[model samples]
Target: MRPPNTPPARAAATATADDTEFRTLLDRLSDKATEDYYNPFTTFDWPATIPTDELWMSPELLSFHGTELMDELSPARLQALSRWESVNFYSLNVHGIRELLIEVTRRVHTPGFELPSEFFHHFIGEENDHMWFFATFCLKYAGKIYPDKSVKLPGAPRDPDIENFLVFARILIFEQVVDHYNVRMAADRRLHPTVRHLNHLHHQDESRHIAFGCRLVHLLWNRLLERDPDDVALRELRDYLGRYLTTSIESFYNPAVYRDAGLPDGFALRRRLLTHPARQAAHAKVLHKTTGFLNRIGVFDARH
Candidate 1:
């Protein structure tokens, strides 16, 4: 077995012919990130108070949407729910960005990652700015950012290539799910201007991030296949990623969000909503693009 710290042979060879297209894409993305940079601190005029009477998120994107739960709540209560849910959403971003940053920082400039290090610099900076603005919005307006409650599962031992693939794949899944919400909320005029602008700015940066992530994930997965041309490893990867996707979707339904909105039976409500057919359909809709991409790349079985 290779030493735990050693980078894979396939990964360390930086000038393989297969990498040519990826190199060109990386250059284009890095230049675009430089050209489109913005000061997140000054980009927004933070309002003294975001009105609580208005919706903070697009109603259709709400967890309770398309369910009987929607009709059960009065307008005032619904607005309260939207406010807290909005805070919860941004809180998730702060936590998710922190995790991805750590993972990316660890790999940047490490063996096998030399070519992408330049773009990694841009990615790391933008994501830090993202985490800052997200946390700022949460603390400035909501008084606190919700604590991350995601449970990390123990995994079987794996080689460096597998570990690296899992890290980037998880990041890609997280970004795609978030970009779904960002795209919708940014275009939603019904939301507060601060909320809309935050989403719009995030979506702009994430578009490039998502593009880079997709290419990198595909490259890594292909490298893994070349190193281990076996069905067992492929099956394991698919199963692990499938569970990660489910967990990602389930994080959106935080019981604390319901409790903060003054709803009773917060945990019970979360459970019921999660199992509801309408909510299931909504989950599938939100994850459609991400799942389709994975399927096309053969990371996921089409039958799933």
Candidate 2:
């Protein structure tokens, strides 16, 4: 058997004698991930049934959880909404992780990028598993996965350094944001057993991914600083990330989910709930940890 501390042969071979501390950190983290890895396929007891009448997501984590709008919902309506909201959350994971998978695979095996590339292999494998289970649950329960809208706001920086940094930064942001859901829902006993188990499984893998992402951002930022050092572009990237977070937060307030849940004037209801002061406060609270970490790492000067 391989020693507990030994990273796989591929990863071990990539770490040279003069590797930087950053590379060493990546190596250690990758080793730990391998040692602690779980097979996403068989990790959970895939329930033959999931009870929709019971809460799928915690009441507090729902988009309208603390708002007046939620108070208006009957117990039955609230339970129904929770089911769809859980679908939306999982659907978002499927699409968001797909994007990151593309970005990571594109760069994983490129020449002259061997150190972190070793870890990218594991990252790609884990993400594929995540997409599979998330999509599977959504399809089995909701009948379809949410489709992603292909849209990017204009004025994005064209610099390769800025572009590359944005990819990893955005991945970190998405993971951290969804992690807010995973951490809470996983521990809440009020949710269905299958739902709680899925959350627990995701949280287990993401803890490693989040650790790697934070360090990756710092490393990428150091590279961008040396090569570009353009404050204007940096700020633009930060603002872009802020926009990404806002849109991600708003996705939970989906009009379709509201409409299907039998709510009237779905669009109008979405607008009200999204603009409510309480919901606005909740958005900030949800993102606080991620934004705070990014700010500390010099990715942004302020919270998103």
Candidate 3:
């Protein structure tokens, strides 16, 4: 990690860290890239095209607080929301995946990481295909993908090689974080077949990604420890990840989801659900998964 409040003369910001997070994240990236490299081409059993006539996604899955706002909607509005949620969720995935893919591309070829260097080529290929499938759905059905939100964070700008790992970690964390919805949608029979398949496929790939991330975090964290016992980098990483946790919880409150459902009160409801103790407990599930492994390896502090 970059020294906190370091003077500019010491080094340029985002210069590579010599720690193990850099090496570990890259290897995981390479592994995922390798696993997902032919993702759509090999994995998806597409036969011509799935019909889009019925409800694409379940409305309940899109609710801001797991409460029904759609029950209050006029039949026409209710139907529109069902259609919109399918598109909305898919669009969000496209946007989120695009950000993750770009991060993967930027840091994949950064110098000095030999193992990652080998796999970086495959990482880009996998993401490119993932993007293609997502974009294809949006174009074929909804006309275009929704634009990405403008989110900016100011922490250490990662060294290109190191950046790949941190960025990918964030991506993995984000996925597991929001997986409550994905899992719900994947199983909910009320959703259209196409919607179920989309979540099912993404969830399948995400399982591998999550596994890769868990192992990588240990390898990198251990490496960081060997480099420095009382390293400030670990603190920075914890703090950064905590912030990521907040964002993951907040993403579920789509004001758009509310307005379409005819409940302008959706934003307020979102605030409550997102901050609710029960909801927060739900968020803890993934943190538990990641932290348990980190603890078992003796690399993590039990305190959040």
Candidate 4:
């Protein structure tokens, strides 16, 4: 097992060798993205109406899944909840893609990023298409995209490497979590064809994006380890990332979604569902792959 504070032995190799490996991976991923590209606007045959009776998302992926709250809802209310939750999920994608685009655009072609700038072009383009499709789905089906209510933490002075790592790490976390849903929904026969198709397309794109993100995060994190070996910094990074993972999970339990679904005391329900043992287990399952990757890369302690 890798130590929590130390970069993986492979990641700690010579910077020159790491750079070469990363560039090679970038080239491969870029090529894959190009080959896999599809016009989001024309890819889907948007239906005139999605039946309200059918689920828009996989039931197991819902925020309240496995909880008493889920069992309490009538079949009609359950379907209604799934509909709003599905819209909320896409709305999150729109906001998350916008944020990542700004961050990636800020660094693309800028100093210290000359090598990856080319791949960033493909990344930015794909993310924009993702945002467009997600927003369109919400508007056409739900009549409106849910407003983003996430609060941005104030920026503090930090080393350039730390800033870069945090930016990309957040992006990686978001993509990984979203991809978890995308994969399940895309394959779930219970969902509408349009829902499955949209998720299928997003999942295909996210596979490449997640691959690129993992390599870049490994590179950036290793750079941080080399420059700052202090245990304090390692602990702080671990704690911050743990909190971020929790926040990402919490976002799925939106009060707005609960209220839209006709559930009373939306805030209270969110709190209750988040703490339920069954839901907690579900959260762990959802985050299993991502947390494992972070732990392996030494961004999170095994105990985390």
Q: Cα deviation of 267 in candidate 3 (Å)?
A: 3.5
lDDT of 4 at 168: 92
TM-scores of the models, in the order given: 0.95, 0.89, 0.69, 0.92
Quick one: best lDDT, which candidate? 1
Clashes of 1: 0
87-144 in candidate 3: lDDT tens per residue? Answer: 6666777777778777766655444233454554554565466567777777776676
Backbone clashes in model 4, listed as residue pairs = none
Cα deviation at 89, candidate 3, in Å, is 2.8
Task: Residues 1-304, candidate 4: write the lDDT tens digits.
Answer: 3346654433333342447888899889999998999999889899999999889988998988887778898999999999999999999999999999999999887655667789999999999999999999999999999998876654422756678888899999999999999999999999999999999999999999999999888888877877766887666666677778888888898999989899999999988988999998998988998899998998887788
lDDT of 1 by residue, 3-91 (tens): 46655563354433348898899989999998999999889899999999999988898999999999999998899999999999999
Off by over 4 Å in 2: 1-19
| Sort by lDDT, top down from the best | 1, 4, 2, 3
TM-score quality measure for candidate 1: 0.95
Pairs in steric clash, model 1: none
What's the lDDT for candidate 2? 0.80
**Residue 181 lDDT (model 1):** 94
CA-RMSD of model 2: 6.4
Q: Which stretch of 10 consecutive residues in model 3 shows the poorest summed lDDT?
A: 8-17
* TM accuracy, model 4: 0.92
